[model samples]
Target: MSSCAKADASSSPALEKAALLGREFSLAWLRAAGVSDPEVAVLFDQVILIPAAQHASARFADPSLPRKIVRTIPWSRARDHHLVLAEAAKQQRLAAEVVAEHFEAAHRFDLARAQWMKAGETSCHAGDYKKALRLISRALAIWPWDEAADDRARVLREMARCATNARLTDEARKAWEELADHARDTGKHDLRADALHQLAILSADPVRAGELLAEASKLATRELGPEEAFRHGLAHVDLLVNRVRVAAAKLAFVAVEEAALKSKNPALQSEMLGWKALIAAMAGEAGDATRFVEEGMQIAITHQLPEQVAFAYKRRANIADYAGQYSLEKHSHNVAIRYCRESQTGEEIVCMGCLSYACFRTGDWKEALDTAREVLGQPDLHPGLRAIAGGVRGMIAAFRGEKASAFRHLDEAIRLQRAEGMVGMEFLTLWALAYWHDCQGEGAKACAIYDEIRTLWRESDDLHDSIPGLLFAGAHYADHGRAVQLADCIDIIGEILRKNDLPEARATLLALGAEQARLEGDHEACDKALREAAALQIKAGLPLEQLWIESRHPRAEDHKGVIALATKLGTKPLLARLKGEDCGDSASGLTPRQCEVLSFLATGLTSKEIGDRMGLSTRTVEMHVSRIFERLNCRTRPEAVALAQARGWIKLP
Candidate 1:
């Protein structure tokens, strides 16, 4: 200002006049330097016009000088000065306004970025990817060129992966597209590779997905260093592993097995090995399944991957349960649960399901009930697990004699199975419902459900192949006097037994044969059958079955044999029943009508002859014999006669 003042003073009058009127020059200069309109207006009022007017007033000693100068200047020049001052004010305002405006814009940008970051984190945490993707889009719009945008883009790509993990295929596709666009725009090679990787996952066309992942792997290998690129290679292997597993689940086992053998990633190789084990188990290759699971276990143990260890355990449990090794099944389930808990994984539901079945098979109903309760509480359980839990509960209720409650649970299980399209499990639920009906003595209803199950089993080709639902159906029919059906079921059971060399099947067949012989009234055949059945029962260590068989044959000759066998078997209850010594209450001393039926049976009279002699329907006579058998702890007329003679209720001549 000192030099400028001296210059103004020493300048020619014409130049000084020009300087005094230099408002246009100042305005143009300030405008060019980015001053805003409002700032220019303020400068006009406080600096330019006011200072000039005050200087003119003080120097001329005339208040009129200000007015004279204002008026004497050409109208065009005056207008130009006013316009220039207004423009300078505008430029000043624009420059100052832009600071806060840009700051607010930047703040909005930061907020959007933070929102996207939170969404991405939440998506990764909760596996809800659609919301994360939408939030990221909003962020990109707000701050497309932000410094942290690349990091956020990377997160968006990861969110896409989460979408694929959650099975949100469509949402994953959208996220992949966005990531691809970002990669293309920003020239981030790693981002490009990641986007392509996700695109591989999102692509419904498996061929296209494979191609994309292959390209991505090659690109990553070329661009990224070894440490950074290893993850991409692993991801590519994981995709192929998942694809193969999906195909295997759809029953393309051979192809999937071949693909799994070709996998390179250690974790994926272990997982595919487990899948191969499951397929082998299903295909009835127990030895192969065991070998595959062992290999997978070794790999998982070496890696210290608890989740993989849990998976291996589960596969082994399934194989054991399928082979009816209840103890081994229980051990495997325990290992699975331990590993799942250690890894903080949610596979406890599967382990609990296995434990429930194993406990049920081993006759530990209380343990089964407790494990089923725990399975029901897990929120992350699959629908199939819900159905299985309900079925286990129904089994517990049935065991406790709560028929109504059991039926309710069975119905709920059926409903869930149908809703989930779990056809295999639906058959199991139906079987339970039929068994419940059989327990309630609703034989007709049970028969109808059993027929449906038989049809389903045959259609699914699952009978005696893997699951044995049909075998139970056969047993149910055999117990209820469907002999022809029982014989057919016997053949099926025999084939399965012969093929598998199962001792349990031999016992079931012997029991069924004994029941058939008893129904035909061939005492010799019945005696032989009962002796053989009891021997097999004893060999199997089935004290209960031995008791049941001994109770079935109670004629004087048969009774002697039964009591001898029961004594040998240490079955006191069966021994008491065979001796006919007032076992428990004795049905309040059989009614007079029962005595009349017993008299005819003692005389070798048929129910028709008894009906003719007593002037009653044959059905009525048969009913009397049934009641007499129930009252006398006997299963046949001869047994009833023997018991009556021992009780002095009838003279057997």
Candidate 2:
């Protein structure tokens, strides 16, 4: 391809040696590889080779030139060039993979194996798992197991590490299996235990993961001290939590705590206590969660455990979330991040994601969006943290009338959470999607997703953290007559509310009751429920939610208050919906019943009097009136009647 390939036979020998040095090489490396003639450097001046980064370096201008040159040389001469290049690379302390390539080209597999193994390890440390796996495979392909048993075992470990980090579960499993067999054969109990633990991490089935963890822990206890086994025990506890087996995870934690106590490890005890708080929070035991956080924080502070202190603060944020203490939740997440930064344990990313959730709950949309964007921008974030960031951004986008962005972010969040086996996290994203659809008046789409969430809630114990948000969504969906199972929402949530005095639970439950009353056409009961719910929400320090609840009635003052609150909070979606900017329907977005209510209101009849005339319940009349206000985008009955009159929907003499 290059003019050098068309060169005479006299120049072919020097070209062949340069080709063996690779397509690119420094003049010094070329000289070390035995093509030291000063004329050889000048030969590359004719554009077959070009200057490279370093002075006196040249790379073939045409990629195919090196292969073409190699083809003209005999394998015997090429082998000599390879040997020289390999020795030269080693003397210069080049990259292991580079030296390995040369040795492999020279057909010295024995020498190549160690260099390839070293290259793989370096790649693994660099987080280049794909390259690491390839290099490790090359080393294993020619491994002299009997002669270098220790190296073989170490390479196997590196292989598994690389594969796991790459999320190549099948390859990781295969490597771990081989490592386990080799460890058993060599009577290396520690390696066998580690293999079992790693295999457990790769397993998708929780039961199998638990079994492997148990065996690994037992093996570790038998060979080493109880301290060595504690890691396996804690991992099993985390597995149980991921599986949503909170009760089982709690019991597992007890065993882990016993091991921690036995080992006299304060750090382990602090970590165990932090996990205990998390499990309690997940199970809706807010009091227990708070107590556990306090205990964990005390131990972590006394022991000077930075990581455990971060853990305790993270769990405290969880407890605050469950208790509807939004301010505390935000504060705790900030504190956790501070400690996480000091520890450099990477937990700060998780705290940042949780902080976004807190900001969203507290109606700080700008802060929520900014914090989530920051979390999403970080590289190599854990899937669960990424999912949290995505969910928050999506939900905020939905509220900001960014329909396309809402779906894009929410869909990815759901996918990531599901793939990570984070069912609890998945429900939050699902609720956000369903609520967005509900707000858009897409009843079929809303109900479909709500049904899926309901089914999951029934099948798993993981929905406790999601229930508070679900309650609000269910009420909104019910108001639009798109609710999947109102009775189930009321029953399950009522039972939970009875069991725990969650600060937000009572208000959300009452909001659900208001929706039920609206559906039943009980206008008086609906107003009463909303009033009580709004009062509770206000008392709980959630003015945004309170205004939202008050807006269900849509009185002139209530509409003004909600619009003001939404404006102040930068809740663009809510403000737009209130202003009818997001409404796709015509000005006559009211039903026949709503028009009838507006006609009665035009006559200056009270709800009770209107109900008497229409032969309906008073609350039914009130419900119709609220719908008319919403559909007409009016803040008062007079506004609704005036709008209907102007639109020629209704007229009076």
Candidate 3:
């Protein structure tokens, strides 16, 4: 109906038949469709065909001409041509997807289904998951499930796999659930266990996910070999570890380690050792963590297993982080990222996310921001890693005064991390958001967030989470004069520090103690506590935390080093807060009274009115105004007010 001038009524009948083959059809296909050699030669002479870019012999010169010509023919005639083309394609061994299309056009769906399944499987192997999903869905559409149970089961498995790879979580879950039911009915325990394992991976509800994993592990142990069962056991342990159930993770790891040893797979043993190291590190078992790391590193290096090697290094970094050895943490994470890169296991982004946090802790804000951005830029990054990168980006943005970007990233990080069961990352992001609010003087909002964190900590009763939680929340409460709330957090922190004995934890407790002293107006106690906290923070190598403790010193001149370091780190938020503390000596050289007058000038108040408010004579107010303008090198009151505000010398409100 739609005309390409090249395809008119006068076109050869053989060409019209060839058009049923597709836009592109071979000379041999035309002959096999019963077109004579001379007819093909005549069609070529008429310039109705052209050389195809594909290996096919020849194609219609105007591709649309084929569809037009085919439309002109009756369905019966087209069906015959399609059947012939399908046969020719089968003999020529064309792509299964291509052959399936011809067979479907010929209404031979039984034949089409097999080719479609094959095509889908091929696409899946090629990592074209969306295409594979489409093709498998097509195969399922035409074939009745009970008619061919084996084919149906295979199609469902591939459907779930492709859907998972495409990140269609709901669809993948449904398919896996269906497959699990089918496997159970068929008494295929191994298949059922594998389906359950996949379901656990997609489930967002931690309790339901853990249940599924536990069942999967039992089934794998009962029906599969030791190695397969160990794999499932390790997955369960990993879920527990990620959820901050450290004691439960440790208990689960005992069986997993036994299974790994029974399997006698060196790589699995090494991987198990790595998880042991991480769990031990988190549980404050430093000696056990060190022993596991040594054994894991030796086995991984001996086997030249890059992924296992990376796993060992990442656990070592975890140990360093727990001990407050930030420089070693950064170096170990770098090595882990390097090994991840070499292994090509798609875990480099996750390691980079860890590096970003380490860099942030060490006051390398620029590198942290860059690494976070790079990790976030990956389109297919795992949800947990995405949460990590997003948190880092949000925290850095909050520090640099990008309020909107900070809120957006931080909110998404919390949502995704919680959904992915990354409790540790979720807590960190919440703390960052609360810290951002604190820096903005939104004390109520900051405390509200901290309250939510405390509620979660109470519900989980996870010491691994509580140490950082209580410490950070206490810092916020202290800053905002929430003395009762600060006392509560301090008590919990003191209890945790007694057992953990981590230097960073001790420093945070000391800092909170200083704040408590300041609130009570005990200047000597505050100064002494601050000095101890600052020294501990320095030994722990946490410059940012150390800067905060130093900046809290009542004598601003004594803590000039804090301002200098904050400036060098380009931590704009800290610099802003520190400058506010030392506002008496502004860069503009305006005296405290003169700075006060500059704020009043910005409000368009006359000298007499400002004098009335300050209990000074109009002449004295004018003199302060003149001094402000002279020091600011401004000729007009408006100019002086604007410049002073720009330099953060005063806030009008």
Which candidate wins on lDDT? 3
Ranking by TM-score: 3, 2, 1
The segments of candidate 3 whose C-alpha lies over 4 angstroms from its true place after superposition are 1-108, 118-128, 301-307, 337-349, 377-379, 461-469, 479-481, 581-653
Q: Which is the winner by lDDT between candidate 1 and candidate 2?
A: 2
Q: lDDT at 326 for candidate 2?
A: 87
Question: Candidate 1 or 3, higher lDDT?
Answer: 3
Cα lDDT of model 2 overall? 0.76
Candidate 1: where is the Cα deviation over 4 Å? 1-251, 421-428, 463-472, 475-481, 522-653
Superposed Cα deviation of residue 517, candidate 1 (Å): 3.0
Lowest-lDDT window of 10 residues in candidate 1?
54-63
> Each model's C-alpha lDDT?
0.60, 0.76, 0.78
Q: Rank by lDDT, descending?
A: 3, 2, 1
lDDT of 1: 0.60
Better TM-score candidate (1, 2)? 2
Clash tally, candidates in order: 17, 6, 0
For candidate 2, write residues 526-642 as lDDT tens digits: 788888887888777776567557645534344666777878875654564445331232224455566677777888899999999999999999888776666544578765665
